[model samples]
Target: MSALSQLDRGVAPIETGMLPRPFVVRSRREELADCVTLELAALDGEPLAFEAGQFTMLYVHGIGEVAISISGDTAKPDSLIQTVRAVGAVSQAICGLAEGARVGVRGPLGNSWPVERAVGKHLMIVAGGLGLAPVRPIIYWALANRDRLKSVDIVYGTRAPDQILFARQLLGLSAADGVRVGITVDLADQDWSGQVGVVTDLIPSMLRDPDETVAMVCGPEIMMRFSGQALVGAGVPAEETFLSMERNMKCGIGWCGHCQLGPHLICRDGPVFAYPAVRDLMSVWEL
Candidate 1:
């Protein structure tokens, strides 16, 4: 995720510019064999304030920087929480950092989800694998104010049971706040009991009027494309749906061409965009 400068939109601006600040790891929790969530405290002791869906530039001292989303509740401004999967050299370095390790924190960056647009509308959050991390803050926000909508449905798919993020919390949240929770896995073990298929298979069962629903999708690019097709096939308008896209980001700022996707720069223009605006672009090969 990338951020427009605080000087631009007032929504949830971080300190302006690309300069990195220091934050100490308060604690870290292993969510899966390859994933961990870090609770960070600013050297100044302030909570990391940001909007839902925004991300930060986390820099490991001897390593480098990588853009990762803020996965903690937006309601909690006193703590910065980021869940990361160990996928590369930088990520591995950050994940391996011990308690009390210090790292540079650049931002609460990028465009956030269209939470404002979804007000009074029923919500459908579709996520695949760790894509749940990007949408987690939005889930927390909507659930915190559950009465403002008709319903909130979460559809998540992973490779298997053990790879699900926030499995324990999803159970409790499902029973409260009238939120409907659905899970599916592409591959399952003998212990798995839920639906077994693609994440899009759960769409038609959502039942809300397509016009009254606002869908938020984030996952593998191909999975998102299929999810978009299913939701639209089920009646949701393309413009009302949003997708959080991921790309190879070199500079969190748009100066570098690294994250370019046609005319839009994924880092600056969005990690979040209305489906209609990006449907064609996302279909481009290797985008």
Candidate 2:
């Protein structure tokens, strides 16, 4: 009934240069807790060029499609990286897949975070729980071009200490000059000596120029709502704060009605939106 299904049945395999080729998984690793990192090699041995913050729709045969943000750099186009959390049936299938398995992929889709606009401005990134995956690319980009940006700060929060993703990598970034990093956990373990509180509390201590800084936040809707308020209260402008939204994105393209929120579709217009753009929509329930 779906367009993809119809195409699969009726369309002949044509060598269209524009169509994306199915890539095979070269390796997969279990990262942090309950997360899988997949490294895919293109079937044709060509690299996929994509901007930071763009996502791809990965399709599993006889299963379903899931939108995964591309975690690797565009400069290294030979391989692609996707970090996914095992949270659903489809995701479980992806997590269960082994090396050399074939998976269909389409995209480099959606608008990326405005990295160009972020240049020359102090950047503040706040990520919570699995929200870290979507923002990971931006962090990598900032570090890769450290001299271009003025200052960088990252604040990541998870349910508990064990739930934190990219622990060693974040710690390394924190030690780098001109980059400040902080981690918070809702509940602390015996060994956890760092900050023990909500992520909002850490915002006040980070040195930032409210007028010249841009804050990007990705997390649960409730978390982002409160975080946005906290940033605004700290003198960061409303327009300077951006939030990445999550909804049931049944279709990666705009045709499906599953991800509609107000005048936009999470699959099309967002997944990332400036805070003011979706403020009203976030206020409504089941939107």
**Who wins the TM-score comparison?**
1
Q: Which 10 consecutive residues of model 2 have the lowest summed lDDT?
A: 11-20
**Alpha-carbon TM-score of each model against the true structure:** 0.93, 0.91
**Taking the tens digit of each residue's C-alpha lDDT, what string does model 2 give over 199-269?**
89898787388878788898888889888888878888888888888777765667677888898888779
Screening candidate 1 with a backbone cut-off below 3 angstroms (N, C-alpha, C), the clashing residue pairs are 2-110, 3-109, 3-110, 47-78
Which ranges in model 2 have alpha carbons more than 4 Å from their true place? 1-20
Q: List residue ranges in candidate 1 displaced over 4 A.
A: 1-16
Report the lDDT tens digits of candidate 1 across residue range 1-287: 33454446664443445677899999999999989999999998767789998988899987899999999999898889999999999999989987899999987778999887778988999999989999999899888778887889999988988888989987567656789999999888999888999898888887488888999999999999999989888889888889998888877777677888888888788889889878898788986
> Which number leads on lDDT?
1
Models, CA RMSD each:
4.1, 3.4
Number of backbone clashes in candidate 1: 4
